[model samples]
Target: MRYETRLYNALGVRLTAEHSLSTGQYEFMWFIGGWDGCGANDLAIAVGATSKGVDCMEAAGW
Candidate 1:
């Protein structure tokens, strides 16, 4: 089957974070929301860190 390509706006709710170190581009993510409210799109914009995630904003002290 042939594939189709497209551009995405901020409203796109990323289904997954497919990071590409070579080009720094994410692919195969799904966009699932409307862009209207200021913070409404914030949740859809950023993905939460997993249990093994690194938090630079957190304190270094254990």
Candidate 2:
């Protein structure tokens, strides 16, 4: 059995925050969902946490 790991970097990141809440949550959900057969362009546009400059690794399994 193997393991999978995903890395996200937000070193020089900028986020838009307002009175209600930060757009971070929404973006993360959409980005991750895209990988789960949610929509398209899962690699385009930095949506949220799991956005651009993110690294994902899926190891072999049995």
- In terms of TM-score, how similar is model 1 to the real structure? 0.15
> What TM-score would every model get versus the actual structure?
0.15, 0.24
State each model's C-alpha RMSD to the native: 11.2, 15.9
Q: What is the lDDT, from 0 to 100, of the residue 53 in candidate 1?
A: 22
lDDT of each: 0.26, 0.36
1-62: candidate 1 lDDT, tens digit per residue: 12222324321334223321111112211121243442323433344432112132123221
Where model 1 places Cα greater than 4 Å from the true spot, the runs are 3-34, 45-62
Please, what are the lDDT tens digits per residue for candidate 2 over residues 6-60? 2222211332222222344446444665676643255455445333323221111
Alpha carbon lDDT at 10, candidate 2: 29
In terms of lDDT, the poorest run of 10 residues in model 1 is 20-29
